[model samples]
Target: MYMNKSHSRIISMVALVATIFVMLFSVAYSSGHVNHHCNDSADCPICSMLAQCESSLKSLGTGLIAAVFYAVVLSQIFTVSLDYKYQSVQTTLVSQKVRLDS
Candidate 1:
């Protein structure tokens, strides 16, 4: 099936938005707010920052996977719509044989 320019643009936008959101989320997580390590084991900005960085990496990975899944889902929906629209191409009505009286 042929993809229109708008459909391709929408797909690109989805990817771009996902990437941007994930990047922002990672940055926010790495800023020490998401992983403030202050217990008996460790209590310092460096420790907090380290934990935050680790969490950020994990979050980024998860976000990437989620984005891929969503993109695939959207593509499938688009494909299904395309298939429905051109379903007549699958069978030729003019080729159907009919008796004079049935």
Candidate 2:
């Protein structure tokens, strides 16, 4: 089986996208989300801070993951086009063989 450069690029892009998603999910659940300070219920600044920080972390993580997906998708799109070209060549070769045999 012949492997094309485009196939390699597509696999690489998929790996990159998967890596980005894992990084984002990890940061969302693994960051410092603990409450170490106490204040009045109406003015629980520590809790508010943690919430805001977690929100920001989630947003940033998601954005980074999306960016990586976009880049990888672009790379894979080109690879898919190359694969299409390969498919056409393959079909033509098979048809030629059929004609030569007859």
Which of the numbered candidates is closest to the native, going by highest lDDT? Answer: 1
Model 2 superposed RMSD (Cα): 11.8
Determine which window of 10 residues in candidate 2 has minimal summed lDDT: 26-35
User: How well does model 1 score by local distance difference test?
Assistant: 0.73
lDDT of 2 at 87: 42
lDDT of 2 by residue, 1-102 (tens): 888999999999998897677556555544554536565645876566666666766776788899999999999999898777434445566676655655
All candidates' lDDT scores? 0.73, 0.70
TM-score of 1: 0.43
Q: Residue 49 of candidate 2: its Cα lDDT?
A: 60
**Candidate 1 residue-wise lDDT, 15-95, digit = tens:** 889767766766765664644546654657666566666776777789879999999999999989888753454545445
> Candidate 2: where are CA atoms >4 Å away?
1-41, 82-102
Segments of candidate 1 deviating more than 4 angstroms: 1-41, 85-102
In Å, residue 91's CA in model 2 sits off its true spot by 16
